[model samples]
Target: MTDSESVRQDTHPSGTWDDIKELPPSAKLVAKVLEHNEAMTQQTIAEETLLPDRTVRYALNRLDEKNTISSSFSVMDARRQLYTLDINP
Candidate 1:
């Protein structure tokens, strides 16, 4: 196999983490938190990461743009959204 392909496989087995690894610090932090937890809201992420609400929002956007994360309306509060890593990627 080609060296580049080998490197890709070695670095990003899921292809999801590799893309997230390239994102900004806040995005990476959010991804890591989600990696451990089943799911969390934007507020929960902000509290867990100790990042500002705005930063958390921005990070979530970045993750969404890369298709690394997915969101669904919260069952507890439809106004709130729950975010989780896209395992299929």
Candidate 2:
């Protein structure tokens, strides 16, 4: 499809995340944040990516469930969870 056609076909504002443009809107937002940063807490990603905390949480959870990335808490904040791309154990 042409760029304009794609625009018409696309359902949401896009390119917020390079790896996520083709993903569903919510997933796209989260993917963008992950792609742009080495790692990010779910909350920080929620803020930077302009998605709700629950949405960010859900997306992160899905990516983790898929084994696309791994997650752990920061040394400083047990409450803060960081997600990083999974290249293998």
Candidate 3:
């Protein structure tokens, strides 16, 4: 959600949290994971969104291909991923 939209949701309880249901299936799931937690790996996306890991991986790959988001990995756990919205893109 945008800053203004979040502010509006804060003031109102008109299905604000249901924004996830309004998104395109894949983006919707990704949005939910990002909203609740800090950074998310494909694993986190799978667990949080109830999407299969392969599905999450594909969606994330598509997001990257479109330059819609960015990701990195933790040094301690190379498999642990971190994602960030690519506002500049």
Top candidate by lDDT: 1
Model number with the top TM-score: 1
lDDT of candidate 1 over 1-89, digit per residue (tens): 11221111111122367787779999998998988887788999999999999999999999888877767766556677777777454
The estimated TM-scores of all candidates read 0.79, 0.64, 0.60
What TM-score does prediction 2 earn? 0.64
**Each model's C-alpha lDDT?**
0.74, 0.57, 0.56
Candidate 2 regions with alpha-carbon error over 4 angstroms: 1-23, 87-89
The residue-by-residue lDDT of candidate 2 on 1-89, one tens digit each, is 11221111112222222333344667656765676677677778888888888888888766554445556656665555676554332
* Residue pair clashes in candidate 1: none
> In model 1, which regions exceed 4 Å deviation?
1-15
Worst 10 residues of 1 by lDDT: 1-10
Better of 1 and 3 by TM-score: 1
TM-score of 1: 0.79
lDDT score of model 2?
A: 0.57
Please rank every candidate by TM-score, starting with the best.
1, 2, 3
